[model samples]
Target: MDTPKIELTKDGSNTLVHPKYNAHYHSTAGAIIESDFVYIKSGLDFFIESTQTNSVSVLEIGFGSGLNAINTYRYAMEHEVFVEYIGVEKYPISLEVVQQLNFLNFFSIEDKEKVFIEMHQSIENKNLNFSEFFNFKKSFQDFSTINSLNQYDVIYFDAFAPNDQPELWTENLFSKMYASLKPNGVLVTYCAQGHARRAMQAAGFSVKRIPGPPSKRHITRAVKI
Candidate 1:
């Protein structure tokens, strides 16, 4: 795979633009802000508050830059929550590209840069226990190949846009996601298209359109009920 080009987001964090697809790994306006709003607040925080659970198992669809994974880890540490993060990515970014990202600048923790490096360097498909509170694993596989059943509490569906990858937004894939989630499990995505919402609904999820991050009007949150 061609190495993605690093570009500075509006929030001063780096986002990768795919060489072939010409799509960005995150919103150009702000990478960190987008992840925080769409995945952390809308998905992780909501799950924690609603279930009152100290442990959360999250499956992320497109672990492009590892931004979502690192942010999730940070959230777990700050809240004293136990997090099991499974990130799936077909095209893992080159470490050289990862080294260029400025994600650590937004964080304030001892050796946070090392933690970020560890996230990228960790072995794929094998669980890496970063701490008693955090377990992480990266799957170098496509999301459609995931056949897990009732295994996750939340999913960060941060795949490329539907217009860019329409097959990923289909009802068939949404059905798989619905099956992967435990009852009441939530799936959050930045895509708020009507067809995507209908796809989730057709897959048996209770879909809701929530306020989006900066520069976007709305996002989708679907629950397995």
Candidate 2:
């Protein structure tokens, strides 16, 4: 892992470019927009609609820049949904970098900067009640060490690409992910690679390709069977 340098996506949102991975932390087309389509609409909203549940638990791999976390928190506040999120990041970014992002401009809430800063700087492993509807915890560890079984309703697999982080996108890891989710729980990711899909299928998931965000052809959503 390397210190990711900040860059602007097509949607004018900030994203980080990892030198070691040689990849953008998010899509070059858009950061927040991509998250909205893949993570929020496909994962969170889809789970809520299918299960008719007011509360949902989510596991996010590669919590870089806290982009997805803040987006999820904002969504929960807007929709009055209760969200319990676990954000896993082995190499956490500094609060100084987090503050440089323009994510707060996307929301209308008061003290958005303060809230976002707090989330980025939160203590690792301890649950933080961020709001009435959103509870967050920063799991300061490697994604491979995740051991939560049959726990989360949805997973935002936001890790780097397979070519960059091959170990994270494997059958063995997918098996763990399958075990980490409740029956029928889903895992959504920007990746639609054949290897990833096969690995998910091999791990007992029902995988499918769905329409992607702008500038992308497809993404994967794997469901626990």
Backbone clash pairs for candidate 1 read none
Tell me the whole-model lDDT of each prediction, alpha carbons only: 0.92, 0.90
Candidate 2, after superposition: displacement of residue 124 in Å?
Answer: 1.3
TM-score of each: 0.98, 0.97
Best by lDDT: 1
lDDT of 1 by residue, 50-158 (tens): 9999999999999889999999988988888999999998888878988889888887756678778887887778878887789999888888888999999999999
Residue 102 in candidate 1, Cα distance off native in Å: 0.2
RMSD after Cα superposition, model 1: 0.9
Task: Note the clash tally of each candidate.
Answer: 0, 0
126-164 per-residue lDDT for model 2 (tens digits): 888878999889888888888888999999999999998
Give the range where candidate 2 is weakest over 10 consecutive residues by summed lDDT: 106-115
